[model samples]
Target: MKVVRFICRILLGLVFIFSGFVKGIDPMGSAIKFGEYFSAFHLSFLGNFSLLFSVLLASAEFIIGIALLLGLRMKIASWAVFLFMSFFTLLTLILALTNPVSDCGCFGDAIKLTNWQTFLKNVILMVPVMVVFLERNKFSVRYKPLGEWVTLGILFTGILLVIRYCYFYLPIMDFLPYRTGTNIPKAMEIPEGAPQDEYKTILYYQKDGVTKEFTLENYPWQDSTWKWVDTKTVLIKKGYQPPIHDFRFTDQEGNDITDLVLYDTRYVFLLISPNVQKANTAGIMQAKSLADLCHGGNCAFYALTASPFSEIRNFTEKNNPGFPFYHADETTLQTMIRSNPGLMLIKDGTIIAKWSYREFPEVERLKNDILGYAVTYYREKRESLTKTILILTLLLTLAVIKILQLNFDRRD
Candidate 1:
């Protein structure tokens, strides 16, 4: 019985550690996963709080894991672990039943488990946690001074804040759909008579005497010397607009204009945001600075929001931000960028660049993107053809070589 309890403790501790570490690496991903749950329930209004909740939940898991591993406060730690596992089991079961999300993201992108799989995994974990809960009174260990708990609490609080700040700026780690996403054109209607398939081709580039391939699945993170290009090859079915679309909104003054389409003569920076009151004030100010830079460069700029005209006007007036505030649908703006204050760059109806409010590049970086040659529209098609040809050629060559070798052996 004692041996069984020891094994259960170790198992529970390891499970918590693995789960917490995976989530810690990408708290933002966890936050987005939580947001998916909230959105499915039509509680998307809670999206703004997802990040905060993610940090707290992740910290709790890490702290509990440490306490469990150290065998400190067995009674409290066991109860906490059991409760946490119980809640997790309920959440996973609910998710599996409703299928609200495709992946539970229990381990973030580090481990992709389907809802049912996660449900089963959690159900199994419940056993150990339950054992610990039942036998906690019998468990004993050297007790640490009360000061240790206080110190740990303070340390965890600081860690949470730092993690939140990092995610708010440059995400320490990206583990979701948008991690190093391909830079594809946005806002174009699909032309008639396009292919229909989910086929993706990788572009192989030769650099520094080595060949490297970049595919939609393994992109952005490549060898330092290798460059990756994502050919946005999509088969357009009937009624399929191009994956990209310009954001059009009405300004506070009631003027109808498209934020990204203006200034076909130069780059246009469209800052997609919720109303100032709805967004973080600091984020708004940072976006305002970027808008000011665009204004100085004779580049067209607009701050798009979904708020009422009067509210936007009053907010702008009070803040004295020198950019035009435009109104768009709340849902549409959110889809364009997950961050509250996001920026998109468009030229000739093509999305040239995009940045979360936290990652808004300096003026010089924006200039570099504008000056670079925009990706050609036909590049995706060309790359797809090239990949198919290369693969077929390799197969044919191998077949011929094998046939020749067989004939020679027969003749001998």
Candidate 2:
């Protein structure tokens, strides 16, 4: 029984540590998943805070795992594990039964689990947690002193902060649909009837301090670059023609036009929204506000929906969004952005920014982004370079600690 308990503790601790570490690497992805839940519940305010909460949750998992593995506080660690697993099991079961989301995002981008798979995983985890909790008092282990606990708490907090910083500055991992992905161009189709202009040029600043310009036509290794950059979307360069099959649908006025195109020189705000009837009210309100901001800036704002013209026109008129509405294929819109109400910013046919419904930075906040594009771009680059180094360092540190503890145990 003692051996079984010890083995279970190690297994549970390792599982939690791995799960927590993977999620920590991509806290933003977890937050994005949480945002989906918030959207489903019509809780937009919680959306912005989801990422922060996700980091904290992941850090807790790591701390608990460490405590369990170290045998530092058998009673408390066992209880914590039990409670955490219980809550997670309930959440996963609800998610599985309700099917509110396509994915539970259990393993972040490192692993993908369907709703049923996540539920099953949680159920399996719960069994061991329960066993540990019930047999916790049977294992004789002293709790950590207050000082050690405080130190552990501080360490966990620091880890969470570092993870959050990595996520905001440069995502350590890309698990979400909008993560710098390879299929960006194909996912966001440029309409055929859209006007063509000069191809937008990319000013590449190489690490060797050489600057070169490349257009989409002359862009070297386009596919590889797309994959390397993990570009979720790109602007359709001016003067570059889309495939002839890129058809534009008509509006209520019978005008065969697309609401906004990548060819335009002006900044374009493309709101790829689900049907208004199906969308959250707060999301609809946010879209309206964004449209108002675009109108104030004389930026082209187009609300693209998969609904029929009559339904969209009526919704627009009723909402008084003041922006033109266009039609797009439902699947196309979904592939463009994972969020039900997704926004994309394009300038001169180059995609500048994108946000899920929950992560929508207000229009006023965008000025800072525009002004600091160079800094932000470089920061993202640096963070990407450092991600592998940081992950490896953490793994090595954990392994060394475990080895030292095993040596101590053998000596005892």
Candidate 3:
């Protein structure tokens, strides 16, 4: 029973910790999904507070997870985790039955799950949750109160700092389809011999002022009494989905410049803002300053937004951002960058780097220190890999310590 309880506690704690970390790292993504939920349930009044709620929920889950693993506050933590799991399990069941939203945003974009799949995941988690609930009262040797509190406090502060940094700057880890080093033109291409669209063709023939429908296999093409009136095609299922769909840029005249921009060999700055009105003017000014440095070099800049062309014209006239404004879908821009006035760098059809409005370097620093064709691929790769390694190491170390302590208590 003790062994079973320990395993269950560890398994459940890991799940909660992983879920919390991923969502905490990209709070904006979680917030956006929460907005989807709010809109779906017609509780749109809570949309503004979605981010705050998401962060707090993630933090609470993580704190409970830490408490469970370290055997700190087991009574309270077990009850909290059990209630959390039970509530979400029921919620996921509802989602599976009703199909209100496609994805439940449980794991954030780090992992995607269909409603049925999510329900199944919750069902599997319920096994360990039940074990924890039953074993909640067990108490033995554990970390000192001061040490446990200090460790938990540090973890809590660490996660908040991570979220804050990612909010102000781009996420330390980019998990989007358009992450750095993705070749734009290539990602948008559909591979040859891929699954084609499935459709059912039905022909409507009018004879004596009466319309009759016929399938391709049964339709009479040579009947003299039947006059063809219309053909209707019903799509049965979607076909191949390219990684980069809905990624077109258009000018005021409704001319697409996707190829022109993607094919540009020189460094190109892409100013992405889903809503121009909401963008920070200071960020736009920073973009302008960076654009000034591009003048004498092989660098170029363009602003892509979802705001109306008229509003864009007015905005540019009022505060010339030093770049031609183009159009993209609002959702696309938001997916491209969570920040209102995020900046992206591309070269020769490849996305090279991305930055939030707050992270762009100063003009002098940009020109002298970093702007000479900064290849961020290597830097981002090394940093992300190192961070992943350290986090995994720390988690493993803590797990080993917990096991040794449990063994000592058993011997005692």
Candidate 4:
């Protein structure tokens, strides 16, 4: 019984911790998923609070996981876990049955799960949840109430800061297919002998004021009296799809210049904005400055957006960004970067680096060589993020050790 209780507590704690951290790191992505859920459930009015819900959910999961793992406030943490799992488990069941959204976004972009898969995962998790609930009172507190809450408050603040930084800048870790170093053209390729999509064609026919649906295997091909009403193709099975199937660039005149730009020899700067109307004005101006920096350099600059031509024309006329704006898919743009106006540098179809507007390279840094500066900046940023995570982990470890030491002293 002791062993079982320990195992259940650890298992549920780690699962919730990972789930919460991943979602917290990409709060915007989680918010986007929440908006999708709201729209699908015909509760679009709640979309305005998606971000709020996203932050709260991540915080709750993280706190609850820590409490369970450390045996801090087990009474409350166990109840929280039980109630949380119950609600989400039921919600996932409905989602699986209705099939309103394809992916449940349970782990944000870090892990993709179909609705049915998510439901099954929750169902499996419920076992440990039940055990933890039943044995909640068996665990002993290691610290005073004040100490436990102070630690939790610090953790909560730390998580919120991390989320805020990621929201203003970009995600510390990129999980999307369009991450830096991905070759756009190569990522969009389909392997030879890949299975094709299998669709069943259903033909509808009307005769004598009656309509009947038939498949090609049973259709009355020879009957001349049957009048064709409609044809419907249903996808029986999905096939292999490339990671970047929906990415394309269309010029003002509706010309596909994807190949031309992707195959270019020199570096190309692409400023991506999913919606021009809601984009930050300062970011737009910063992008304009970047365009000026690339004017006579070995790089060319362009802005790509999902906004309509009218918005683009109006924005261009007012801002005069000194670069062309092309049209792309809104969802693709959103998937590419979390920032509204983000900068991406690609050369020969390979994404060299990406930056949120807040982290955009200063004009002074790029005065000498744009590519050289960008490469150095990207390397430094990557190292910085890695170091920050390591420091946080070390601090948490030290804190836990100190707490354990204090508990031993008190016992002595």
- Which structure among the candidates has the greatest lDDT? 4
Each prediction's TM-score versus the true structure = 0.54, 0.50, 0.82, 0.95
- Stretches off by above 4 angstroms in model 1 are 1-11, 21-55, 99-105, 108-114, 134-140, 143-151, 167-170, 185-270, 281-289, 295-339, 342-412
Candidate 2: give the clashing pairs.
Answer: 180-230, 181-230, 197-238, 197-239, 198-238
As for candidate 3, its clashing pairs are none
Alpha-carbon local distance difference test for all models: 0.67, 0.66, 0.80, 0.87
- Measured by TM-score, how close is model 4 to the native structure? 0.95
User: Which ranges of candidate 4 are over 4 A from the true structure?
Assistant: 407-412
Ranking by lDDT: 4, 3, 1, 2
Number of backbone clashes in candidate 1:
4
**Every candidate's CA RMSD:** 22.9, 17.9, 4.8, 1.9
**Model 3 / residue 28 / CA error / Å:** 1.0
Q: Give the per-residue lDDT of model 2 (tens digit) for 45-73.
A: 89779967888778888888877886756
- Per residue, candidate 1 scores C-alpha lDDT tens digits across 156-267 of 6645654665456434444433233323333243566865345556666556776667666775554566654334454333344354454467756667776345536677
Higher TM-score: candidate 2 or 4?
A: 4
Kindly indicate the candidate among 1 and 2 with the higher lDDT.
1
